[model samples]
Structures are given as C-alpha cells and as structure tokens.
Target: MPVDQETTARDGDTPDDLGSVQYAQTAVVPMDPAHLERHRVVAHQKAHPASWAFDVLRTQVLQKMDESGWRTLAVTSPSVESGKTVVAINLAISIAQQTNRTALLVDFDLRRPSVARSLGLNRPKSLNDFLDGHASLAEALVNPGIERFVVLPTNRPVNSASELLSSAKVGKLIKDLRERYSDRIVIFDLPPVLAADDVMSVLPRIDCVLMVVGSGVSTQTEVEEAMNRLSKANMLGVILNKDESPTQNAYY
Candidate 1:
C-alpha cells in the first residue's frame, strides 16, 4: 500500500516561491558539524575506560549497526532515568557523522519527552502532531546543530502513546520513512520496556533494538525479564552505561 499523494502533501500548502521558505535556523545553523564534533568527543569518553573510551565505543556501535543492515533502531532501557535518552541522542549524533548518511532521531517516549529538553530545543513539533495528521514530517523535523542529523522532538505529552504507536497509521508512517530515506538512519528513543508496552508495539516495525543499561543501576534480572517481554529475539541488543568507575554490563 502506498501513502496517498494527497496525504504526503498538505492541503493549501504550496511550494515556496524561489527561496521564500528559507529560514535562518536551517540556513545558518551548523548543527551537523558541531554535533558530530561534540558526540565524537563524548563517544570517545564513553567507549574507552580511559579518558576517551566513548569515541571508540561510538565507532564500534556504528560499525556493528552498519554491518547488520540496521537503519531503524529503537533505543530503550528497563526503566526510566537509565540514560537511554542520552545514549540515543548522542548515538544518533555520532552515526550521522558517517559520509553521505543522515540520522533522524525521533523521540517516541511520548509519556516523558526528555530528549527535547536535554537538547535544549523548546517546544518543538512532536511525533504526536505527525501521527495525528496535524503536521508533516518535514515540518516537525529540526536540524538542531548537526547537518546529517535531524530530530523529531516530542513536544506534547500524550495520554495513550502506546496505543498510537501500535496503530496501523504508525506502521505505515515508519515503512514510508524507511523507504524514503534508504540512505539515512532513523533512531527512535522509545519508552522503557518495563515501564510501558510502547516499545513492544513498535518492535516489529523497527530493524533492531539497543537496550541501554545504566551501570550500577540496572540489575541482571530486570534486563533478562525485559528481553523476555519483547516479541522478536534477534532485534534486541544491549549498550551498557558506564559509571565513574568504568564498570561495564551486557544485555540481550
């Protein structure tokens, strides 16, 4: 099934007459360049046990995800405040640095949209507007500070985010995005699996899942039980959140 042409383009929306749509943010903001440099430093710090392990970990993650034909991935954790949002945003920034590849970081944790706040973006258009036919995807996307990366921040808190995610409309939207941006990657910062069934709903729609586990915070039992709750087996993996002591953990 194809998304209707009428649906893709909004009614009464005419193409901007030769640069009329030009905006200062998209035109002047060097979001991509700055974001990559920041994330490169951050990844270095996270990946290595030394001062710059994050960079190495970032590279490893990119390589692994690339090798697996992964484009749409859900970043989740066992519970909230586990640094899942932090990892998702930084990982998306790191991945967007790849040559000729763009990354779309979507905030699907509709119940608590911390990605936008963490990034300092104020009340941006959200996944709700896009899913509810209130805004076009492009209109909802913000360039932020990265050229190859765009973010769809969830500005409004939804009452039933899980239901919306599981709807047929969401499946079709994600499918269209995957096909449209074959060269780009879509990273969703999903709600915690144990906290809600939102991630479970979108499990079948995404390419893979990256479980973010906070060091000293997430227990083995929680990780295992969360994995058992997911629908697909191979789609899941783990990214450990290191502590000041640099302790590491793993997930399925």
Candidate 2:
C-alpha cells in the first residue's frame, strides 16, 4: 500500500560489512555461470541483457516493502508455470546486489520445491531437514556464491503442505526469520493461489505477497477467483509473464 523511492540496480554494490561466504554459518555452494543464461535465472547482466525485468521488479517491490516496514514477501501465481519461482530467485539476487540490505529466498512451496534446482544447488541441506527436525535452521540455509544472498531450499516435496504451513513450528519459524535481522528481506516462493490452500494457510504469517499471472495460462475467471481469495492480503502488483517476446514482457 505504501512506497519508497526507487534505487539503482548496482549489481555488485553489496555492503562491505555484509561479510563473505567463507565466514558465514550457512553452507556456501557454487552456482553454474550458465544457469542465468540458460533461461532459468533472470539476474540482469551483460550476458542476458533482457533479464533487466527482474531488476525493475525488485526495485518496485522493495520500495513498497521498505515503506510499509515489511520484512517478508510471498511470491505466488494464479496457477502453475507462471514463473513465480524464477521471479522469486531473481528478485532475491537483485535485491542482494544493493548496498544496504541482504536477501534470503525461502522455498516455502513444500509441495513442489524448485529453488534449489533452479539455482543449480545440488541436493543441499534444506527446509525438508529443518521440518523433519533432522537439522537446524542454519544447516538448512545455503549461499549460492552471491555476496548477500542466502536460500532455504526444500530438497523434496512434503506431504500435507497446507497443514504443515499452518503448524506452530512454522509459525515460530516465520517469526524467527522476521526478527533475526534488521536489514534482511525474506522472500518465500509459494504455491499457486488457486491450486491449493497453502497460500492462504501461510499468507497471514507473511508481510505481503506478489502475484504472478502467466499470459494465456489462466482464464479470466481463474484470475478473478484467485484475486478474491487474496482480498485481505497486502497485495503488491501482479506480474504478466510467459510472453513470447522478451522485449514485451510486462512487469506491472
């Protein structure tokens, strides 16, 4: 509902005090340089010039979050294949590129987790471990060679995702993540709003949400239904994705 001033992308402007991965408690992993150029990642750069869409999206989304004092953001779609996960990853990377804040991308889509795969993180310890009580939160976190970027990836799909999202354990997890750091933006890559009750289950625990609607993927009725479901959410704008022409990709 509120907005802050826009800022430059400045891809490598992460703060000097943010510290390096070598000293971080989270496990540091290497992301293939080819992943971004492979079309899965959209971190705008010289190699993938058209990926600047994520930078603009990040600026706008972060502006609203900063103004509203929101620390967590949920990224979801009306239905499947709307590029929500990709958007989440790119936004996290784009935000981490800034000088003031750090970004943590969490794969909260327990049903069909893809953040690890999308980032080329091979079987890293993840949310599955944390949820099963086999690992601590720090053990589940992964740094994909990005200075201020961290990820809590889900290694596999979990049963009863909606119920899991509503549990007390998850509630405490969200609270801890929110209060852990003063200048961290935690982004959750969630399931489609219309596909399941997972979004509604966890929406209350999050600060705000960004909807991704794929072009020609969902009907007008479906979009309307999904929006009505989010009537109470702190709705950030919707993204028009899956356009055939990259230049015509719509961010608003």
Candidate 3:
C-alpha cells in the first residue's frame, strides 16, 4: 500500500487538534528532535538521509505483512548492540506516519527495555508495571508526539523474563493487542535471539519476526544460529545495520 495522503494533510495541524477527537483515549507525549538524535531514532527527522532507509523498510515490511495477513511483528537481533531497537523504533515511527494505519510499538525486551529511553519518555507506569499487575494496559500506553502511533514501554528489567514472556498473561496480552483493532499494527521489540531464551520464548506468540544484524559485529555462525532459532516463526526478513560502505551509509 502507498503512503496515505491524509498523513501529509494533517501534518500542519496542532497535536491537540489532531489527536483530540480520534486519539483522546491515548496519552500524548511530545518528543524532542535532539533527544531522538542522541538515540539514533531518525524516522521523524524526515530531512535526514537515514530517515529514507526506515521509510523504505516500512513500505516493504508492510507490503509483506499485508500479503501474509499478519498484524503483529517482533523485531529482534542475533546479539546485543545490533541496532535492533533503533530499527524497531524508526520502523514503527515510519509506519505511524502513514495515515491508514495505527502503529503500536511494545518494548518486550524485558531484561533490557530501552524503547522509552530511545524516545526520551520518562513514563512511570509502563509494560513492566502492567505485567507486574501494578498498572493497566491503558495506563501503560503513550503516544510520543506522532499521529497514529502509540507505545507500550517497559520502565526497567524484569526478573525471570523468559518465564514471564512465555506465560499465559503475555499470550493474552499479545492476543488483546492484535485483536483490539483491525487497522492497528503492533510491533514488539524483543531481546536478542542468541543472548537469551527470551526471544525464543516469545517468538511463537507473535505473527512475524524481523532480525537485525550489525555489520562485522555478528559472525556468520551467529547469524546462522539465530536464523535456525527463528525458523519456526514467519520470518519477515533480516536487516543489515551499521554498514559503512561508501555506497551504503548505515542501515540497509
């Protein structure tokens, strides 16, 4: 599907006026461009060259998801520091920028949740609190100054993350998030596939998976191993990140 024209039309409207009617139920949080730059989140920075990469990624991902009838996507990497979180954040932002669909990003990397930090959000109640029974899902949802975008961030690390991820509660949470709205695309930022069993535990619950690999950081063996682990799920594709070739800038 092509990018929606309504997104461009609504770009000039104030956040309050844009979100007041349709997204009144969502908590809106303003995002600072400088803060986003620090975290390498460039999707909202449309003028940046890096932003186009994410826009292209978003289009391709959405086309495959649409063809496969998939709604929930889990973004993970073979190991840490592979720019998977950055990819997840940017891809979600790009998706939300499209007017036809609402994008909901969930920080499911419970052991090292960083989605809130990447977006410069200091939310007290998040996915952590919701999973611990301290807060409701509604209380955990936040809109980070983007139309058609919502985030369910995790504030801190959780104990027994693997167990929690594989638990019935998480299953129900994923089901609810997916079924709540037909026009919504839910993206989950999962832990590294080779770092822990967290990704494996949650893989079966999501509709599709995307693997991000950093150039020169992950070995061929590691990538193969990660792919082996992800073979059971509907593999969306792998993202090659931090590529510094003369022709390619960073992510591909």
- Clash totals for all candidate models: 17, 0, 0
Candidate 1 structure quality by residue, lDDT tens digits, 91-186? 676666644677777898988887777666664456667677776565566766555767778988888988999988778767755655557778
In candidate 2, stretches whose alpha carbon ends up further than 4 angstroms from where it belongs are: 1-23, 44-47, 242-247
lDDT for each candidate structure: 0.66, 0.79, 0.82
Question: TM-scores of the models, in the given order?
Answer: 0.76, 0.87, 0.87
Which has the higher TM-score value, candidate number 1 or candidate number 3? 3
**lDDT of predicted model 1:** 0.66
Candidate 3 has its poorest 10 consecutive residues by lDDT at 1-10
Which residue ranges in model 3 land beyond 4 Å of their true spot?
1-24, 244-252
Q: Return the candidate ranking by lDDT, descending.
A: 3, 2, 1
TM-score of 3: 0.87
Tens-place lDDT per residue, model 2, 1-252, is 111211222345343211211224666786887875465675735356655777778789988988999999999999998888878888888888854787889999999998888888875468888778786666677777777888889999988999999998888788867765778899999999998999999999999999988889988999999999999999988988867444345777
True-structure Cα RMSD, model 2: 8.2
